[model samples]
Target: MPSSLMLSFLFFLLSLSACSLKTQTTEPEKISHINKENYMIPGINHGLIQSPINILSNEKHETKNHQITLHFQDEIKAVENLGHTVQLDFSKGSSISSDGINYEFKQMHFHTPSEHLIDGMTFPMEMHIVNYAPPATKNGIPHYLVIAVLFKMGNENEFISEFLTLIPKQSNNTVKLEKGRVKLHDLFHDDLSNEMKNYYHYRGSLTTPPYTETVNWFVLKHIIEASPEQIRAINDIEGDNARHIQTIYGRHID
Candidate 1:
């Protein structure tokens, strides 16, 4: 081959190598930027009303009396160790109605180190009683009404003690329970109606994935009590799975 042709061929190979390196370097950087943006400000990617916001207890806001009614069977059929959290599954035929909108009780799950902060305070544990209502129209979004209960380290909680030992040892494992063995009524001291009366209601999303912003959050004003050992046992299984607090975004807290 001619000397000039050989030099030109070498230059072409070097240019191709440089372009490949440039492409490899910039691609990861772009992905890193996106991940960082999502981590720093989740609302930019998700919706405005996100779950686990810091609730300000002292803030004054307009309130409306929502005629809430509870028709609870309190029958827990199974207990699941989901790796992410301990869950208690309720049997069918239990529902709650607020202002004529009915939401059926599905299941309840826990979050360690509490998700929603009260007066800028995080409790030892939090339980979310998840309820759902189908969309009114085909194009309408599904609705969720999550009742949150924060637990502080104190006396052992009766409701938790019922199923704490019954939780399956392996992750994703479920153990069937005898009917009335693991009742949700025990959690509310057999008075769910009264316990639900004094709560701070707001609009938020699920703390977990999809983070859909159609949740009607009812964080109980009264913080419940649980033993430190019980809380630690649950945290050990779930680890630290609490989503960081999101901005309130001018949402009402009644």
Candidate 2:
């Protein structure tokens, strides 16, 4: 071959090698950016008081001047099978008054492998009893009082058993229950006041998207019990939906 032709061939090979190397190096960075974008919104998912934080059991908490009263009806209307979680909707008229602010019972949902950690310990399941108070103003931030109950694998939990089989098989489906078919009182053995006496209280954001930072979290100190089979059944439907723990940011846990 002529020298000029040989030189041209060598240049072409070099150019191809460089292009391959560039793709190999840059592809991962591009993919990583997309993954981050999908997982987190710039300002929405981040905040100083984000949820699912590790609750240090030994940490000292300041006593706050607050009073809480529960006017619960324990009337669950329906169960919904969202793709990401199993949720039970509550009937209206049940409300909790905390510091003169009233928050009504809305719904309860579950997360597998838990979200919040107690002394860095992860439970098999976690349930959130979400209550909400509408904002006073048009654009004000809404208020939330979330009661979190962590569950360990032990004897079967009556609360979970009530609606476990009743959950709709398909995602986004809801099954309306007969009156008194499923009761939250059964979970506490009809002793909700005694069961709810002790808790770890804090302020945090919702674990899911639009993680509004106005949540008043009351994590029940008493860990509940559920059978391994029951936990597996719920986990199978929801998969691993627990969010990663966020920084505590020196927040108070009372």
1-254: candidate 1 lDDT, tens digit per residue: 99999999999999999999976655322433333334545445555667888999876365667788889888888999999999999899999988678999999999999999988899989999999999999998788999999999999989889989988889999999998898777777748889888888887788998787778899988788999999999999989889999876556678
TM-score of each: 0.81, 0.81
- In model 1, residue pairs whose N, Cα or C atoms come closer than 3 Å (at least 3 residues apart or on different chains), thus clashing, are none
- The clash count of every prediction, one per candidate, is 0, 0
Q: How would you encode candidate 2's per-residue C-alpha lDDT over 1-254 as one tens digit per residue?
A: 99999999999999999998876654322433333334555655555667888999877356564588889888999999999999999999999878778999999999999999999999999999999999989998789999999999999888788889989989999999888989988776746656666888887889998887778888889888999999999999989999999876556677
Clash pairs for candidate 2:
none
What TM-score should be assigned to candidate 1?
A: 0.81
